[model samples]
Target chain A: MIELKNIKKSFDGLEVLKGISMTFEPGKTNLIIGQSGSGKTVLLKCMLGLYSVDSGSMLFGNRPLENMDDNQRRILRREIGMVFQGSALFDSMTVLENVMFPMQMLTDQDEKSIRAAAHEVIDRVNLNEATQKLPAELSGGMQKRVAIARAVVMRPKYLFCDEPNSGLDPKTAIVIDNLIREITKEYNITTVINSHDMNSVMEIGDTILFLKDGLKAWEGNKKQIFKTDNEAINNFVYSSRLMKKVKEVYQ
Target chain B: MKLLHHIGAYLLMLRLVFIKPTKAKVMRKLIFKDIQDLIVGSLGIVAFLSFFVGGVVAIQTALNIESPLIPKSLVGFATRQSVILEFAPTFMCIILAGKVGSFITSSIGTMRVTEQIDALEVMGINSVNYLVFPKLVAMMLLPLVINISMFLGILGGYTATLYGGFSSSADFIDGIQMDFKPFHVFYAFIKTVVFAIVLATIPAYQGYYMKGGALEVGKAATVAFVWTSIVIIVLNYMITQLLLA
Candidate 1:
């Protein structure tokens, strides 16, 4: 589990995360949803230690991340798995090599074992045929699969994905979402996803933290979202006519 | 003030790059690949430029020494001096600042814009050491290339002198043998080593710290080239003053 207490972050004096606090539970898909500039990405980055919080405590399990020394922080980082928004697979490596990279860098495992582990995760993502292909040779959706495979091959304790379904088609988006949710459950990993996609919110958001203007505008599950009385949450969630009509009928 | 900040940051980055590799086998593989990319890939152009420039230096030296007092052997002597002292080491590095430097900047800048560096950081890898240190190791073999350039350059001068009727083969050979100071070769090697470090690190600094997208990658390459050239020229003057002046 990861916990943030009164986390604040700013860039060039423009505060992005304003005293926000949240706890992400293990074995559940924790989703951060907000408008563009609502500090969703910033909050995710702060948790990933990509951005340092201005004044707050970030606890990974029981240990505060900021208090750890450099070496200790790096040791902790090896336990993390992140899927970048752009699917940042190493361009020089094929899919198999990309997936095997973390093991090669951090483990004393033999080559055969590493290859086996990579193959297992590649199969899990249903990308066995694409293992020999370079990232550029694959489609955007395929590349995201490769990224996810690479992130999970090490069996990380924490999984973070930033905009995993942004450019994907609807069907592919849900497939990726369900895949992540399944992985989170199978490994019992603490998973955090930053997304603005409503489909993802409804499909796999076991818990959703909604931010508006750097503040927590609302927080709830998918079912709770539709039934919430908060006007701001209602305005944002029912912005589409179809969603508004569904809400009208349901209410 | 900005310059001081860059210098400070560059020095700090160097400290990170010089750390022990997290995995020796991976580092060895990266170093060998860099040798192919940074050193071996540069051979053809280095040879081509060295030969042609050596020939031009010989021809120009022959044409200018019309004074009856100056010996024909002076053409070969002048060519040897220019090639060994300035052409092979300093000029070749300036060329590399354009060739290898641009490549380093663009590749690394592309990685930065694409979030590959972030990926490395997220994985607990020191991205600078992972990316830049192998290039530094590969470029340490730069003296091998410079030595080849020296041999080809003098040979090119010999050919030009003999064939262009600039001087007799015997006169040119005598000029080559006259006043041979081994220290000059050592001096050139020293300069090549220093320039190699500069070539590896400066462009890396530009790329690693770069911001923005594809267009900015191109811009960073240009900026890296300009800064590398400026540093090389400055070092050329300073080293010459300290060593030979």
Candidate 2:
């Protein structure tokens, strides 16, 4: 489990995360959703330690991440995995090599074992055929799958995905969503995802934290989302024409 | 106050950059990879450069002197001194500033712009240790290798001049023996080592801080070339005055 306690962050006098507190439970997909520039990614980066919160603390399980030295942080990082917004695979390396990188760097396992492990994850992601191909040769969806494969190949205790389904077709997006959700449940890992897509929220949001202007506007599961009376969330969810029509039909 | 803090921050960053890599075993692998990339990868350019430089030095030195007072052997002596003191270290650095320096800057800059460096950090890998250390080692070591190669190439030029009848072999040998100074060679090695550190560090720093996107990476590469060239020329002058004078 991961907990954010009074997490406050600012950039150039603009507060991006205003004393936000939340917990992401293990074995479920925790979603942070907000409109563009509403501080969702900033909050996610803060959680990842990519940004230092101006005030407050972040805990992985019971250990505070804010004060750990680089070595200790690195030890924690070895157990954590992240899928970046851009896939972020090393473009120069083949898919197999990309997936194998973390294990090779962090582990003393021999090459043959690393290769087998990488191939296993590639097969798990259904990307066995594309293992030899570079990232540029893969489709956006395939690249995301490869990213997911790389993230999980080490069997990390925590997984974080940022805009995992961005730029993919709706069908492809759901496929990626289901893949992430299934992996989270299967591995019983603490998983956090950042997204604004309604489809993704509906599909994989076991726990959702909605941010509006750097404040936690609402928090609920997908099942309770539509039933909520929160005005800010209502404006956000119902502002879309398709969702507005769906709400009207349900009404 | 912020400026002072930034300066301190930069110093800390630089310290982290150098220290992290030294502690990791991964630095060895990265260094080997960079050696293969920077030294082995630029073989064609090195070969082409050696051939042209050797030929030009031999021809120019032979043409400039037409006096009986100066032995023809003195041409080879002058060429040897020029090769040891200036041509080998400075010219090789210019080539490297283009080939290896640009490569380090663009590659790391791209990694920065793409957040791959952040990804590495998140994975518990020291981005500097994992990325920059090997390049530093490779850049530092490979120049010495290239300097030796350039020395042999100058010898090849001498041999060519002998075979072409532009200078007699005995005269060439005598000139080399007469003009050779151990300090000149020592100075050349020292300059190459210093050049290696500057060539590796400056570009690596620029790329590590790259912002924007791919265009910014390109800009970093260009800036790396320009800055490294300027540093190399200035340092060459300073070192020459300090060592030779």
The numbered model that scores best in TM-score is 1
- Against the true chain A, what TM-score does chain A of candidate 1 give? 0.97
Native contacts matched by each model: 0.94, 0.81
Tell me each candidate's TM-score: 0.98, 0.92
- Which stretches of model 2 miss by more than 4 angstroms? A109-116, B1-14, B21-26, B66-68, B152-166
lDDT of 1 by residue, B12-48 (tens): 9999997846588999999999999999999999999
DockQ numbers for every candidate?
Answer: 0.83, 0.57
Instruction: Give candidate 1 misplaced runs (Cα > 4 Å).
Output: A248-251
- Residue pairs clashing, model 1: none
Candidate achieving the largest lDDT: 1
Instruction: For residues A96-174, write the lDDT of model 2, one tens digit per residue.
Output: 9899999988888888999999999899889989999999999999999999999999999999999999999999999
